[model samples]
Target: MVDGALFAGPALRRLRRREGLSQSAMAARLAISPSYLNLIERNQRPVSARVIVQVADQFDFDPRLLREDETIGGVDGLARRLSDERFADLAIDRDELNEFLAAAPHAAAAFARLYDNAAPAALRDDPIIAVRREIERWRNHFADLDTAAEALADELRLSRGDTGAALTERLRERHQIAVRILPNDVLPDTLRRLDLHARQLQLNEMLDPASRTFQVAIQIAALEFRSAIANLAAAPQFADPSARGLFERHLTAYVAAALVMPYGRFLRACEGTGYDLAVLGRRFGVGFEQLAHRLTTLQRVGQRGLPFFMARIDRAGQVSKRYAGASGAAWLDGDASCPLWLAHRAFERTGELCVHPVLVDGAGGAPAHWLTMARTVNGRGGARFVVALGVEAHMAADIAAARGISLRAEDATRIGQGCARCHVPNCVQRSLPPHGAVLQFPALEQGVTPFRFGG
Candidate 1:
């Protein structure tokens, strides 16, 4: 479904079992032979489009579920968990892992959970990391919320009018809540606040028009989609209350963006415009950062746009926001990205789109090439942050900014995940020695790199 053969046997089997149907019974319902169904369930054959349509029609479920199940805490995650040094002695191969995942998905999920529980205290207990992992688990796409927001957008007629004005009018007419733009001095510490007793939604006067619309949409989401947000936040993975709260806020924001852009219209506009950020910003009445963030969420099945990864980094190289979407860029998981990445240089040419093509050395795998676009975005209270959006190099052809950009291996900048994890030789910008490498020093001479390490 995503420009590839869909091999989702485990998901298909799970669905059939959830529906309380035997293989023969489900096969009869799907108008397929039992042997063929078995083959599909075993992942020996890809799930055909006809079969996906039949499943959707008969089960009354989103066809995306099959694909989602395939990735969510599935083989890739299990493989990553198994790659840890603690499990290095086991030497599990890919085919065996695949067979194990297919044969016992619940067991595989339990193992993943076990692996998470076994992680170091810093990673296991951090609420922010927990929420991020949860978000990545779903690839930042919430189908139900998107559907609900799309319906709400249609009902509010958001696409036909000024978005901010439409949301403001809706709040006043339906909810009887007046929206007030208070002086920055009055709301110095907050961008938005809702006073229930006063029946007012207050915003800081410093917010731009696009941000004001987004804040209003958030209020609407909090009021209208409370149940959906709560349901998503209620997932068992969020053991910590802080994680649940953070996830709930994130879901509200996602719904707000969906309400503003509406999935179908946004995807069409993205594809039509070749993903030109400026043009899409003008059309959607959103800012560049918002557009980039929304770009990471267009993972609807059979209608996916490019699998973009987005990050927001400050001048000090601290990453504040990261969504790994399908790009799976290793830098997102690190505390700091490579200095050579365009994101770090975005502040030098503020407000201008800086594009770069780079090859990232992943963990013990082939280097993955990416095309990254970065620009500085004005943050709250005069602060500025660089927002970078990236997609795999192969998928960059459809992007307007990537036009005439060379992604050839020889032309690309080679970067590591981070200084501590990178093993790239002779990198002058590396601030720390690569992890798991022995440092070597030549007493007689000094090279450009401060630290030399054996690979």
Candidate 2:
């Protein structure tokens, strides 16, 4: 059932779906020829490293997942069966092979497997995969450790769950790691590793103070809250130990965010700062992207706060992550990926700020409003994050006044597909009501757009 063209097609399609975009819209957003995007999706072309990172930083996607080779039904098994010397005369260069890996994942995996089997007697298992497998087992130990540590977190009023701060103190006093921040390039991408049993934590020294602080806090989280994050992440799903370890590493990042904002402090900051993204970023010592992500996690029952939504993007208009706790309407689940959603405007103005007003009508058929802000950010790479922040419609005016956002949550030069695909009629940007939208149009001319359904 898995063909070469469809090797990674499901993942690619999922990415598109999560953005709430049709293929043509997504292709346009990325500024690539639709044909090119189609080719890549169909496994006719390889996705470049630049595209990989663009999707990651913009949509907060996992680059490795996109680059991952097929673990099953891959041609690598066959390739491993043949000696490299045998193919030497074929003139298929290593770069071309890598291209094949990126483009046709199943075929590449099969080739690697085959090649490894035929490789010299001493070499067979992939060292990277083997090492990661071990890391995964250690991750499970962390779950037990966290259970023991939870009550202590509650007692200290560490509602901020100060894991990173605690870790820094521990490592500096007991282990002497001398935690330092260098440029991300200067440091290893991996969080913490021991050299001669001496812990070393490296980070991008050039980060904005808030971002730098986050990196430091994240390093600390890896040490202090590893158990808490591990406990939550160790659920049985990831089949490979290597994959599981990567999942834990991502959770480590999540824990660090929780520690820095401490949910309690963050919710208060939202009220105090009027849910202003910039002020919240500065107040919590977190970056725009970081604050944006944490905003979505504020739904903790009685201890809960506004279920603010968040997402990120780049100049090319590709989304990195789209999260919403309110409706569980994930952009990743395919709600809104249109280029004209006022979200893409951030890329054009670059440093210039933008505010978008949105109206949301839920399943109950009521309209809610919200005020949004967007701007561009640069980091390890050129123009990395295109930040977007939105708050509840009721708070839109008060928030707009304080944060200098748009008062009219509806009026903007809105054009194109985002608002159009929506179901709510009377929506100005609605090029077409959704599939089941009630058709209020009386005669032929009233309904200017196509889809008019009263379901």
What's each prediction's TM-score?
Answer: 0.86, 0.52
Candidate 2's C-alpha runs over 4 A off are 1-167, 182-198, 239-246, 327-332, 360-368, 400-455
Instruction: Write one digit per residue (lDDT tens) for candidate 2, span 1-455.
Output: 12212234446767999889887887766667778778878766666656666667667887646635534212322222221223323444334544565556656566555654665653334433333223322311232333333333344344454544654555577557756655556554543333435455555555566665566656666767766667655663544566567666656765666656665566777777767666776566666778777776665434555656666775555555555434223222233455556767677786666777655433232234556667777756454667776666565555633355455646533222244334444444454455434566557465544555554
Give candidate 1 regions above 4 Å deviation: 1-31, 47-111, 443-445
lDDT of 1 by residue, 1-455 (tens): 22556777888888899999999999999999999999999878888989999999999979877754344444545555664434433557655666786566667777777877878988888899888878887778998999999999999899899999999998999899999999989999999999889999999999999999999999999998998789889964566799999999999999999999999999999999999999999999999988988999988877888889899999888889998765655456767788888778889897899999998765554567889999999987789999999998888876899889997877989988678867788998989987677799989999899999775
The CA lDDT of each predicted structure is: 0.84, 0.54
C-alpha lDDT of candidate 1 relative to the true structure: 0.84
What would the TM-score be for candidate 2 when compared with the true structure? 0.52
